[model samples]
Target: MPAAAHDLRTPLTVVLGQAELLERRLARDPSAPVDPAGTSASRARRDGCETS
Candidate 1:
């Protein structure tokens, strides 16, 4: 099921990329506030794949 594996990998890649970006941003400015909605969306994308 390569297609199914690809579908799952896509979202996980996105989540990881977003997390990396967030990490870099926080590193630059540790005082910056994280957006709750953005965090929720990332978690949703991650969880969505797990439930599939």
Candidate 2:
């Protein structure tokens, strides 16, 4: 794979993994409160590191 694609895929993988975990947790307990800063993707977005 190209370096650019790899770079994009890495963060996307992390985001997708976090999303799946959240989905499972929410399924078990829909009343659970979700923290905006709970995932790395959220932190990246807050820190302006996320391009998309």
The per-residue C-alpha lDDT of model 1 at residue 12 equals 69
What are the clash counts of all predictions, listed in order?
0, 0
lDDT per residue as tens, model 2, 1-52: 6889779968877876686577667758968877755655556556665544
> For candidate 1, lDDT tens digit of each residue in 1-52?
9999888888867776777677667758968887765654466666664433
TM match of model 1 to true structure: 0.55
Worst 10 contiguous positions by lDDT, candidate 2: 43-52
Residue 32, model 2: lDDT of 83
lDDT of each: 0.67, 0.67
